[model samples]
Target: MVQADERPASDTDLITLGRRIRHARTARGLTLDQLGERVGSAPSLLSLVENGRREPRLSLLRAIAEAVGVPLNDLLSTEPPSRRAALEIALDRAQRGPLFAALGLPALKPSQKLPIPVLEQLVGMHQELARREEEAIATPEEARRANTELRLERQARDNYFPQFETIAEDLVTRAGHTGGALTHRTVARIAEQLGFTLLHVEDLPRSARTVTDLRNGRIYLPPASTPGGHGLRSLALQAIAHRVLGHERPRSYGEFLRQRVEITYFAAACLVPRTQAVAFLEASKRERDLAVEDFRDAFGVTHEAAAMRLTNLATVHLGIPLHFLRVGDDGALFRGYANDGVPLPQDVTGAIEGQLVCRRWGAREAFARRDKASEYYQYTDTPAGTFWCSTQTGSGDAGAFSITVGVPYAHAKWFRGRDTPVRRASTCPDPSCCSRPSPDAAERWAASAWPSGRMHQQVLAALPRGAFPGVDDAEVYAFLDKHAPEQ
Candidate 1:
């Protein structure tokens, strides 16, 4: 009987190795025989390796990479280097992991004789390479996935962080925000209470709204963020939230996103504390006109801030259920939160983070409104129910984004804009929604007038897969371990 080879090669390893060799060989425009001659191997063997028919040894792979004028790592790694470097990676990970806990021995790489620093450097290099691989893959999709997961987590917590709110309320009370509004005095007091010395630097980075130098306890604000009447009070609140929350480095990407949400929540809570906000809402709810602008005027905050704060009142105090939607200029729903069974557009996984909003909705309509100070009011009827939405569009840092506060028809009578003649029906899931083209458009303008807005995409040679697609599981585990706290 013929004895089968005991050390059989894996299908995955062979396929990955084969693709890498083929790509490198083709890039150099070298024939099979020409490359084989440089590698000191026969053309047939090289061809077999390229075709994934034969598993090449480390020596052969090294020679091939050298012949192709590339490093061994370049040829061996695909989208994920951590998995491709199997044996060395496993041993390297085990050394850092619980496997060698009792041994009290030093960690080792492929060459066990290498010293600790050398091994650490090698592992660090590997980690950097693996991160590069991950970046090369899932640039857009992974970001969207992170957003979707973040939204789900926030929803799980009911979009309200009680702990953060409690802390924010305490801070606000200590700062003496007895009045309903967060005046300049209260804002400055809040900053002083948080131990952050506020400074205004005009020449800060163009993208920088606020910068906190933790060591010196100084919060620098760029004037560009708030060029008009008052400065960025919300920015101050955000920086204060970062400090008072005592938030360390978040472990997972999800946790990092979660912390941002919590920080923002804390900031908003400080800006408009629930105790005062609820009292104001209760007072306003009694009036025939419940205006967000009225709330904005009374609180001395942004229209968007007033709108968002109203969403908190739904579950917290007033018991008026509502939904909030913030859409970009391009009709992308950037921030959306709903607790009143309002159906948000989502994927099969029930993720609404990156979904596009129907152009017919009030959120989209608000963008076209050139009057920056004016609010767009619309009573939209969807499959869910009739929602009365009032949105205010802003320019500058807003980037033409619209902030909307919507309530069900049953609750619309309490709002100010409910009586406005603006009304629209949006059957979002139906094919007819936003499908009809412009009535004034003609066949003559078809070729030249329409903007394609085409963007280039990098063509990946092949999509690679591993236990963790383009990521290192060990690195992720080690990170979570740090944030896990001592058991």
Candidate 2:
């Protein structure tokens, strides 16, 4: 019988063996399906063995050798398992020191030898980590954190391996079984399904051919075009490989699995493009007012995706400072900040008195539109800023909502201490509000909410109907100027 480790003599030998298997099946006058049934496997599996899609398992080879009326040793004479090939590749990497150096990792000197046990230990540790990663499966909080980390790592590596563009294009071609060169129609179908377009793809120049280990997959592209070609390639490989190696595990370990997945390369590449998404965002004047829909149209992303991307954008990238706040009828406080990471003040001490913030803002605007006498009341009062522009949707009074970009005060304090006074009003405005301390104390604690952030803001500008306006540039500069770190 063939042993698992013995290598087949040559490609010719493997092909001859495949041919023998085919001849035996044919001689029996049994269809491939019938032969597959005898082996307790799929026809495709048997066919792949004959066509070399995979190396034949020793057990299968033994059975096939018997079925073919051949001596077991004849079938056993094949080469060692595929793992040997993988080992050889790993050794070659160890030899050049380029593998480590390319990844901006310390290179192992040629004179040094890695202890076999130590290497095994590292692999074992990876397996253990994989297990730990899977244990917390099904928790929404964990899933979200995993997704966020995957998005960040993938975005970073794709910036390095632009050649993976070719890999993606090739994958599309290989996906079809017909084995023809990829045609425009096929490419278009794949692109449309994936929601992306490959632009400015070109072949690597022959002079610069270099193979980079994208930790998960190998990328063969021209080298020396940029600093640390090998390093970038290795980083990209690792990012992708981490995802691939762990994908089979459950959601608890999804981050571990996804890290080995090669898809990270594509995601990262999409983000840090040759031109960058921020350039388009700036060109569109989005900093003035970050409307999720407007940004979505420009990037071809969903509204949520656009908003998240905006949160990641740096002022340096867009040449304009950006700030984001989450506001509701309750009031506005800092939810998050990007680029410079300005912390929203948690201690808001003051309250807006006698303000019909959410309810009367729109009515005041409509009334102002009809007559000059009512123009003074047109501005809606809120904690963030004057209501400049908005777009509303949903039905029933509570469903309608709007987002307004407000100018924050130079030293605005958004959060006040627990001891800070809350206005006298209902126990809890909405019974469904989970933030309420106790269900029993709901209605009695509801706040007579006013605009939360900069309560003093007066409406100097307003968006026309149907527009979701953003904070103005002058207002942003003023806010930043006031809050700028004192020299």
TM-score of each: 0.65, 0.27
Q: Give lDDT per model, in order.
A: 0.69, 0.39
Question: What are the per-residue Cα lDDT tens digits for candidate 1 across 1-487?
Answer: 3234333334346645666676677779998989988989899988777655688767677778888888977776654233333434434454554435535766543542555465566666656655644554444455557668776665554566677778888888998878766766677788887677777765444434565667557777656444433337777777677778887644444445556677777778877787777777888788857888988877777787778777766556766777888888877777888876667777776667657788778899877776778788998888998888888887656467888888888888988878878888888766568755555564557666868663425322322322233334454344334433354
Q: Candidate 2: deviation at residue 297, Å?
A: 2.8
* Residue pairs with clashing backbones, model 1: none
What lDDT does candidate 2 reach at residue 465? 11
Off by over 4 Å in 2: 1-136, 144-276, 285-293, 314-316, 319-487
Report model 1's TM-score to 2 decimal places. Answer: 0.65
The number of the candidate with the highest TM-score is 1
Q: Relative to the unseen true structure, what is the C-alpha lDDT of residue 284 in candidate 1, on a scale of 0 to 100?
A: 77
**Candidate 2, position 183, lDDT:** 36
